[model samples]
Target: MTRTTHDTHPVQGPEDVSGEATTSRWQQVRATGDAGLATAEYAVATVAAVGFAGLLIAILKSDEVRELLLGIIRGALSVG
Candidate 1:
């Protein structure tokens, strides 16, 4: 005995009716085009955040900024 298989929706070519083949191809591309978009965005945001944190750290470590912070702390701590 032998079994036969058939495809209910066969692949469409450019010659398909009403440009459906082009539309279908575009839909498929669009569907999968952004599969990693969110991950890529998160990675970019993470990198930007890390860069900003590094900048903040550098600024805070400056002598002038350190002195200003210390002065502010001293003023806050001193009794009037």
Candidate 2:
């Protein structure tokens, strides 16, 4: 008796997906080539975060807010 091999459509890899294939987050990121952020992007994000923090600190330190916060803290801590 003789044995024969079958020629099926070909094995697929992680990158080989049908048009309707559902991909995991990792596969999507890999396909997108997410090599770290560029220097300019990092710098801009850092500056924006620092500016936001500074704005919040300024708002919190203003006289009215400072008074309000201190009053709330004192009221909460007081034993009635």
Candidate 3:
């Protein structure tokens, strides 16, 4: 098949016709399913952060962990 391009009108092939259908399908899929993906991701991250913070707080508040951290800090700071 020969291909020709003109300044006034571009060539339209079968691919061009199906490209619109593909684009519309993609748009519909994203519009229906991915709209709340960001919110869900944010919510998951927030929950994970809160859980990690709570775990840290619990660990820091424990006497054993506090003593261990203090010992490490004191050992690091002490002069040789």
lDDT (Cα atoms) of all candidates against the true structure:
0.73, 0.70, 0.73
* Least well predicted 10-residue stretch by lDDT in candidate 2: 1-10
Look at candidate 1 and give me any clashing residue pairs.
Answer: none
lDDT score at residue 21, model 3, on the 0-100 scale:
64
Please, what are the lDDT tens digits per residue for candidate 1 over residues 3-73?
22323234554446566666875786676554445877999999999999999999999999999999999
Expressed as tens digits, the lDDT of each residue in 1-80 for candidate 2 is 21223232223456656554434534655665745789999999999999999999999989999999999999999999
Best candidate according to TM-score: 3
What TM-score fits each model?
0.54, 0.52, 0.55
lDDT of 3 by residue, 1-80 (tens): 21346433234555556777657656756665643358779999999999999999999999999999999999999999
lDDT, candidate 1, residue 35?
42
Worst 10 residues of 1 by lDDT: 1-10
Better of 2 and 3 by TM-score: 3
What does candidate 3 score on TM?
Answer: 0.55
Ranking by TM-score: 3, 1, 2
